[model samples]
Target: MTAAATAATVAPVRSSAGGNAASLPAMRVAGLEFRNPVVLASGTAGFGMELEDVVDLDAVGGICTKAVSIAPRTGNPALRVSEFAGGMINAIGLANPGLEAVKRDYLPWLPAHHPGTRVFVNVVGNSVDDFATVVEAIDGMPGIDGFELNVSCPNVKAGGLEFGADLQALAALVSAARTRTTRPVFVKLSPTLGTGVTDAARVAVDAGATGLTLVNTMPGLVIDTQARRPKISFGSGGISGPAVLPIGLLATWRVSRALPGVPLIGLGGVSTGDDAIQYLMAGASLVGVGTAALRDPRAPERIARQMRRWAEREGVNDLTTLIGTLQWPS
Candidate 1:
């Protein structure tokens, strides 16, 4: 990646005159600057506005908002999310107040996207037309820093084929979303095998995706050991949490190396500063926290603080220095 490209994504602040400049430095992801490497994954962090009630928002890298549709979506049925042994299974089908609601309810409250951490909006759709409508709706929504295109939604009726499974479909959808947005577009993909995340990532880049969010959850089910039935009403839901971190790391590393210039926002099961560091070394420019925060709303901030300590302990003053530091097997 070009130095200029790298510089484009980092959020510029006064450079914390008091903090340990001797620790982690600033980093960027696909032209969107981040104060640090720890960001709250979409669907996990509410509009980057709600958390201020618990902690200062200025501390973390960024906030990726919940997935939004062109219009308001009532969302899936009751019993949407269920806890599991090592992770979670969620069937909350893109529930949000929708695009306009975001502007009306969330945008006007924010200060700005300045050194004030990035805010990436997660978008979803059933078709290319669905994507275009969302793109157009959020065109100039205030406080929105960027868009995270959710193309990984499993097609339940299509025998569970992920939108990212077919190269042509993936490229076409990414291109459609890319052409409609002026803000940075971060394409989110599923981890299902043959989804060809790396190949789809190339298409995303070629079609103008600013970066990639590696990965949405994998489709799975919790079977009832006693009843001999599927636990969920839908029979399955997306899996997330610790059980998936290793796969997340592998996916982040593969895509980071494959898509030379594009930035990567690593997410899956990030729960600690060292985990964030590990993702960076594996090629993620920024790391996102999800399921952990589900159990603890303050998880994002906690990780941010932990990252500060981790940076100091490692003797690496700048977080960006750790990007792609790992040597993968040839």
Candidate 2:
């Protein structure tokens, strides 16, 4: 379908901002309601607990906890992160305490401390079954409103990137995950997929994915000229921050245009409200703040406030009207 047609047909379902107020920038996706469009992207904010002291976790719409696997992961070697001219790169390798620990320690904290903020567990795996395994285990877990499948992590040696590129594997993976949870399942896609991303989005949605997160950081390598070696310990890492903003926006536009009915959590290099607004105009139901939040823990709330201010100034009472309103040249 044409972008214009899709935009008209897909009407965003508005919901209350958790009864906080009628004017709050609230939105609902796949039955999960967000108080606003801004969300703390995974990996940057840890599990929302890490930022408790510095940030008001409930200020933003929601938080996507770091990738959780079936087993614990120490992650990549030393130089896991490095800075560059455009943005930052990191090879965190989905390092986390794993599923059981998440169940025992991580999930419980959100409800008690940040009751207003929504939570989506980012699930990773070394294989097809592993994805479902973790999701199934946490399906009934309280405080988790949904799941984001990390099938596009470039830093991993095994199943991460491989599952994203192969349509059959991607289909099977999403299908398996779909059966394990009744909550929303968002497939995080890779920006490096180029023109094929739309096809992948179709496959995922057909396999019963609830939505798509566009996208994960692109694979990159930063060289240390003085040291005559790669700066990142993993040699190559996933590049994030401002450098990936356009890449992610383009992916969101393509997928949103093609699958207008599918909900999208637009993430990449967002630091300010204008950046978040661009994602909304490009058709994202939600905007994720990662590198910016890492740089400043207060960024998520600030961005959300900025969005509200911008909306009020522009007289856009319902932020949902701004979604998928992108216009292409005739």
Candidate 3:
């Protein structure tokens, strides 16, 4: 992107005066400026318009719209979601209104409604070409600041976890999408892949990803003893919530250390400002709120406030200073 185009996408930075710099948690990631660090995770905030009535869209820094596939997805069977002791398990199966519907119904509604809030469309596909095709089709659309490749979705059978797990496949998928648009492309990775997480991150970046969104939902299963069956209709689902917080934090920290300057959107079990602070400290430029927002639409706004308060108390003029500040004992 040219300087003029990049400038257009960014919200202006607040001047620091009288120790007020810490008041604005604004940041620039992958050549795009965000008003704050709190963003609504993908799938949770569908196309922004879905939660417009309940949540204040402008309150959060950005919104990652639901996954959009090449063709509409019917999704999985009944009982797509279930509750568990650790957190929530879901087998949403990447259900969406398809590409054309999004281009017609969703994309235009964003800038007209929530102009200031940055919008990153989540793109999913059944193949590498599918991923590139979606990005190419919507690359220049209005109200879109970037793309989040949903290669890490555990619920989908094809073009999901496999794209993220196989190093060669991941490289090819990212490379294809990279050729489609100049807009930022963030690869969302699976959390279940232990050490491969960093390896995958490296492969993605090398293949032309602008940045990375660490730790998608971990694949898991929940059983009902009395019913002797799975809790969700899909038999198994992606586990999210507080149970995955530590896992996300570790992934963010590890990838951040390995890739040093790469931008990461940290999310898993984030529900509070303090939790977001932990992510920033661990190396995330932004923190995504998913499971918590399902319970409360106002969670993102509340969390952003809490983060500013923490920054004020810590005398941090810029939240970016808190990024990757974790002190590992030698």
- What do the candidate models score in CA lDDT, each in turn? 0.74, 0.84, 0.85
* lDDT computed for candidate 3: 0.85
lDDT of 2 by residue, 20-47 (tens): 3222556776676677777888888788
TM-score of 1: 0.88
lDDT tens per residue, model 3, 278-319: 998999988999999998887887888788888789898788
RMSD of each: 3.5, 3.7, 4.0
Candidate scoring better on lDDT of 1 and 3: 3
Say what the RMSD of model 2 is: 3.7
In model 3, which runs have C-alpha deviations exceeding 4 angstroms? 1-12, 15-23, 153-161
Candidate 3: 10-residue stretch with minimal lDDT: 2-11
Estimate the overall C-alpha local distance difference test score of candidate 2: 0.84
Residue 125's lDDT within candidate 3 is: 81
Q: Return the lDDT, model 1, position 224.
A: 73
Ranking under lDDT, best-scoring first? 3, 2, 1
